[model samples]
Target chain A: MEFTLEDISDDEISRRRDLYEPLTASVRELVDAVIRTEVDDDSVREAHRLVQAAVETLRAEQIDGSYGVRFSADLQGMPWGNAVIGLRNAIAPPVQTVRDSDGRVTADFTLGAAYEGPSDCVHGGICAMVLDHVLGDAGSADDVPCYTGTISLRFLRPTPLGSLHAEAVIVERDGRKKIVQGSLSDAQGQTVTAEGVFIVPKNWDGPMPRKARRPGEA
Target chain B: MEFTLEDISDDEISRRRDLYEPLTASVRELVDAVIRTEVDDDSVREAHRLVQAAVETLRAEQIDGSYGVRFSADLQGMPWGNAVIGLRNAIAPPVQTVRDSDGRVTADFTLGAAYEGPSDCVHGGICAMVLDHVLGDAGSADDVPCYTGTISLRFLRPTPLGSLHAEAVIVERDGRKKIVQGSLSDAQGQTVTAEGVFIVPKNWDGPMPRKARRPGEA
Candidate 1:
C-alpha cells in the first residue's frame, strides 16, 4: 500500500508540520494525565465534561475526510502518518535515529509509563513494534522498498520503562530479499533481539544498480 | 508485571468503570479527528490553543498518582490498564474475545487507518502485538499466570485495514511451560500465523493439576 509523494509545496508542509507538533504534544500530556491521574470521581467527571465539549467543538468544524498520508518532494519517502515516525501520532515516542555509513541504524528513545506492560517494564508488543519499524526502515535504506515477511523475537528480559536504545543491521541479502538483525537494550543490558526477512515487491523497479555485484557477492 | 486484585468492593469498580468508558470514547473520537481534520492553518492553530487550555485546566486540578491496575473481586484476573484490553487507551482497538469451556480463545476487532504500516495495510508490528496479547491471554486462561517468553510470527500476506479475527489454542504444556499457536485472518484468508512459548514464573504456585503432563502431551 505504498503512496507516492503528493505535490504539496514545501511551505505548506512546514505550515502543517508546525501546526500539528504542538497539538500532538498537548494531546500527549493529556494521555499521560489520563493514565496517571488519581483524582476523585467528582473531579474526574468534571474534567470529562470539559474534554467532551472541547472535542465536540472541534468535530463541528472538521472537514469530511481523513488526513491522508502526506510527503513533500524534499522529504521523499517520509510518511507524516507513519505510526512509528509520525509526529502527529501520540503513541509514537520521540524516537531519533542515526544511520551510519556501514548501513546500521541506531535509535534512542524513552518508553514512559504509558507503554508499561509488566508492572514497571515496557510492553513486549511495543518492543516488537519498535524493532519491526527500525529493521524495516533499515532494509529499505538501500533505496529499495522492502516489506517485512517474517520476524522472530526473543525477550531476554523485561524492558524497563525509561531510556532505551535499538540498532538494526542487514545481515544478508538474496536478490530483492534481505535478512536483518536488530537488538533493543536498556540501562541494565540487552533486553530483546530480533531477526526479520524483508522482500521487495516483484513489480518494483528499484534504483539503477550502483555496483553490479552478484546475489551472493554483497 | 502482575497485580493482585485489590479488596475494593464491586460497587466502586462499577462506579469507576461507568465513569471512564464515556471519557475514553470521547478521547478516541478526538484522536480520529486529530489525524483526519482538514481545516485551514488558522483554524488548526485556534483548535490547538483551545485544546491546550482545556488540558492545562485539567492538569491544574491534579491527582498525585497514576490510575493503577484495578480489578473487582469478581473479575480477579482482569487488568484494566492492559495494552490490548484497556478501554482508556486510544491506541488499542476495541478487541473483544470469548473463551469457551475447552479453554480456546477467539477474538474479533477492526483495525482502522490509525494502525496502518506498509501502504494501507495494518502495521506489521501491530499484528505482532495483537498476536502476542491474544496468545498470551489464551495461555493464561487455566487460572495460571503465564508471560510471553518468545514469539515467532510469519506474515503470509498484507493484513488489510478492516475487520479481523484471531484464535489461539494451547498445543502442549509441561509443568509451568506452555506452547501456544495462533492465527490472524482477514476476509481474504489467513494473513499471519504465530507460535509462542509462555512461561509461568518460577515462584508461581499453579493450580493443582488434574494430570501431570509431559512436553509432548496435549
Candidate 2:
C-alpha cells in the first residue's frame, strides 16, 4: 500500500524509463559477468544453462508485486527503482546528479567488480552507500524532503576502482534539522568524508514538488 | 591477483557454493519479476524483447574475467563475493552469523522490496550497510581483521520492512583500535544504533587467518 511517483503516467513514466535503462544496462553487464568470470566449469555450466533460460523467459510473463517506487514527471527525486540512485537499479551506481545554482550537490559515478572492498578498494559499505546518498541529497538542498537522521563516515583513503566523485554541502539548519556536508572522491583526493542529519518528516506537511526536486535542483 | 578464500578447493568450494545458491535464488526471482511486472505495453515490449534475447545469449557465451573473491577452507574470512554477506550476492543477505563465546556477533536478515528506503523503510544506506558489516565484524571479534575506521549512526526508528536484527560487541580496545557497538532490530525495538572505529590494517602483518574468525569466536 505504499508505491508512489504518483502512480504512473507521464507518458507511462517515460516509456517505462526508456524501457528500464537498457534493461538495467544488461543487468549491469550481468553484474560484471558475475564478478569477473573466468569461464570453465564447462563454461560455467554453459553460462548456467543460458542464465536459466533467461530466468524462465522472465518467469513466464508475470507480475504480482514489488518494483515499487517509480516517480517521474521526468526524473525528479530520481526513483527508477532506487537502491541508491536507481536507473532501474542493477544495484545502483545509477548515480547521476547535479544540483547547483549555488546549492551544490554533485556526483559522478563508477565502481565495478560490483562495488569491491579491500584488495582493490571501494567498499567501505560502498563508501557508506555513496555518502549516505549524497548526504541525503545535500539535506534536501532546501526544497525540503530530507530523512537520514544521522550519518558519519571518514574513510579518508582507499576508494579506488575507477572514476568517482561526490560532493554535498549545507552545513547547518535545525528545527526539523538539516546539517549536511559530504564527500567521496577518487583519482586521488578525498576518499570519504560525510556528516549528515537530514530529518523533515513530522509527517511531511509541505515543500517537495518543485517537480520533486533532484536533477539540477534550484 | 587478489582473489582469496585461500585459492579454492574445499570440494571445489563446496561445488561452486552449491552451484551459486540455486542460481542466486533464481536471479532473486528474476529480480522480483523485473520489479512487479504488470505486463502490457505489448507485454512490456514483449518482455523487453525477451530480455534482449537473454542478453544476447549471455553475450555470445564469452568470458573474460571478474568473479574475484572466493574463499572456502570452510568460509575463512568469508568472501564469497561479498557486498555485505555474500552468498554469491544477489545483492547480499548472505548474512547468517553466530559468534558468541562472549565475543558476540549476531545477525539475522530480511529486507526485501530489494532493500527499499523511506517508504517501507529499510535503506538508510541499508542501515549503514548492516551496521558497517556488523561493526566491521565486531572489530574482528578478537582474531583481528578490522577495517572500517569510522561509523556513527542513530536513526532510532523507521527500519520496518521485515525480520531484521543485528548485533556487534567489543566495546573497546586500542593499539590497533577497535571500539565497535552495533544494532538494528525490528519488531519495534532498537531500529539502528552504531558506533565504530575498527582499524587493524597498517599492512596487516599477522592476526587474520585464525580461519578468518567471527562466527562464535574463540
Looking at model 2 chain B, report the run of 10 residues with the lowest lDDT sum: B209-218
Best by TM-score: 1
Writing each residue's lDDT as its tens digit, candidate 2 over B1-218 gives 15455665657666766766665655555555555555555554555555455444445544343344544656554465566666555666556667778877888878676566555666688788778877777777788676777889988877876789899898888798889888888877898898988788778777655664643221
User: lDDT tens string, model 1, A1-218?
Assistant: 54446676767766777888888777767666666566667766776776676566566666444344444554433454556666666656646566777878889888765665666677788888888888876786676767888899998988877899999989999987899999999977899999999998898875623321111110
> Relative to the unseen true structure, what is the C-alpha lDDT of residue A30 in candidate 2, on a scale of 0 to 100?
62
Per-residue error (Å), model 2, residue B135: 9.8
lDDT of 1 by residue, B1-218 (tens): 54545677757766767877776666666666666666666666776776676566556655444334554455433344555566565555646666766878888888765676656678788888888877876787676767788889999998888889998889999877899999999988899999999999898865623221110110
Which residue runs does candidate 2 get wrong by more than 4 Å? A1-9, A14-47, A50-78, A85-87, A90-131, A134-138, A144-209, A214-218, B1-9, B21-81, B85-87, B92-142, B145-176, B179-196, B199-209, B214-218
TM-score of each: 0.88, 0.37
